[model samples]
Target: MILIADSGSSKTDWRGIDKDGNVSQFRGVGFNPYYQTPEEMATELNDEFLLKLKEEVVAIYYYGAGCSTPENKKGVATALGNLFGNAKIKIEHDLLAAARATCGHEEGIACILGTGSNSCDYNGDKITDSRPSPGFILGDEGGGTSIGKKFLQDFIHDEMPAVLKEEAADRFQLTAQVIQDNVYRKPFPGRYMASFCRFITEHTSNPYCYLLYYNAFQDFFKKHVTRYSNYDQKKVSFVGSVAFYNSDILRKAAADMQIHVHLILESPIAGLTLYHKDNL
Candidate 1:
């Protein structure tokens, strides 16, 4: 059996491929190496996913956030090996997952847009290179967290029209106290960041959202992928809910920038799982 995992700051997608080549997918909580060490992360996995394990397990490939550093990658692999016992495990950064999904048989740009954001240059089967994934600090331009930050700023600073503001407040059930607690007293700040995605998507077709996508895509392209001018003319794809589900405007924005878009996946976990099954 081969196991593949695509984990982010919000949720982990676990797919198990049996020896018969049957495929099954499972879900677990978020495990970010920036915050959760492998020991801690494996504990969460054990509690949520230990039941899925069997004696016939063979190879495990994990593509996760914050595993870019060699030290972190080795540490995470060790911790997971401890959990999986003698299972052969390979740990890699999430960008590889994005690359394999977006450029399964061709070279292009691939971005993961979930709780955080990252972009990479894929040469068909592997990530030949990637932009600096700056977490949520100066980057994550098109991610759910960024959208949520925009929505909160609009609501908190009275940027929205009076009627829309009232509607949004009523719709999301947000209060000053709730915002304070969620922002400051929360366990996962990224989840709080994700809280604003639905609200922003509610107004996605508006001028505000139109500009938001345009600006964010431009920034992501300029700050990240453009350094590789050789690939500038190729298509760029998006993976995750914000960019995939809201692809109408995102596609237009890319087109406006003369960028061809090849795919928009609600969750690239499907592609990642299939890649592992077929290739690994």
Candidate 2:
């Protein structure tokens, strides 16, 4: 059996395929070497369902966030090795997952717009260029977290329209103290902030909400997409919940920038499943 995983900081989607070509799918908690230890990851994977298939897994392809550095890659590799002792494990950064899932051996620009955002210039099989992703705190333009950050700032400073402000207050009962606690005292603050994206999507008809997403995606294009050589000539594709749910706004932003959007997937798992199946 082959195990393919597309993981973000928030969740992981897993697909298992047996020699007979039958497939199974499951979900698991997200893993990031930056936050969890190898032992912790192993423990998380020790569930009955995962353990039952351990011996059947011949190969494991894990593409995830925080797997960019060698140390981080080793961390996840070690954890997987502990569980699937006989299986070959290949670990890679999530940006490659987006590229593979969206571009599928075609040259294009792939972008991830999830809890965090990233982009890479993919030349068929490998990433040829990429911009620095300073994570969610410093930068992550067009990501849910970034959008939520802007929403919070506007809400707190009374910059949002009065009706939307009242609605936000009524819906979330947010306060400055609550914001500080979530961002500073809680775990996975990026995910916490991204949770508000649902509210933003619900209010897209409002001019304020429309402009918020428009400006955010525009910033993403300027800061990341424009840096690539002749980026306008390449087809742009996206993967992640932010891009999937707000495709209308994303397409508008792309059109405004005169860039063509080729694809937008809520998650890359399905495309990844096909990629792995065909390659195997």
Candidate 3:
């Protein structure tokens, strides 16, 4: 059996393919080697995932956030290796998962716009170039965290339009202290911020909400996508809830920048399952 995982900042999607080519799946809270310790990740995985299949897994292909550096990759690999001692495991950065899922065997620009954001230039088989992802605090321009943080800032500062402001305030029961505590005093603050995107999506018909998404995606194109060589000429694809849910505004932003937007998927797990299935 082979297991493929697409782990983001908020959650992980796991798909297991048996010898007969049958597929089964489950979910778990996300893990990032940059944040969680190896022990913690192992504990969480052991607690959440089905234990019955532990020995059945012959291999694990894990693509995850914060696994870019060698140190990070080793940490994640060690944790998974310990869990499924019989399996051969390969740990890789989530960007490659996005690239494989979106571009497949074709050269293109692949972008991730989930709890956080990243982009890379893929030449059909490998990532030829990529911008440094400084995480949610410093970068993640087009991601859910960035947009939600911006919205919360406006909400806190009384900068949002009155109608939207009132609705958000009432709907979320948000206050300055609550927002601050979630962002500053909590763990996985990026995921907390990204959660607000659901509300934003529900209200996208509102001009203020629409512009918020537009401006965020605009920043993404300027900072990440536009920097790639001949970027506008290449096929651009996106994988993440932010890009998938707000594809209209994302496309509008891309149009303004003369970019051609191609595929958009909520998660790379489905595509990844197929990729590995074919190879296996």
lDDT of 1 by residue, 129-161 (tens): 777777675678778777677767777888867
lDDT of 3: 0.92
Model 3 agreement with the true structure over 99-142: per-residue lDDT tens digits: 99999999999999999999999999999999989988999998
**Top candidate when judged by lDDT against the true structure:** 3
The superposed Cα distance between candidate 3 and the true structure at residue 193, in angstroms, equals 0.8
lDDT of each: 0.77, 0.91, 0.92
Backbone atom clashes (below 3 Å) for every candidate: 0, 0, 0
Better of 1 and 2 by TM-score: 2
Name the better of 2 and 3 by TM-score: 3
Which regions of candidate 2 fall more than 4 Å away from where they truly are? none
For all predictions, the C-alpha RMSD in Å is 2.1, 1.4, 1.1
What is residue 234's positional error in candidate 1, in angstroms?
1.2
Over 4 Å off, model 3: none
Per-residue lDDT tens digits for candidate 2, residues 119-194, read 9999998999999888888899999889999998888889989999888888788887888899899988888888
Candidate numbers sorted by TM-score from highest down: 3, 2, 1
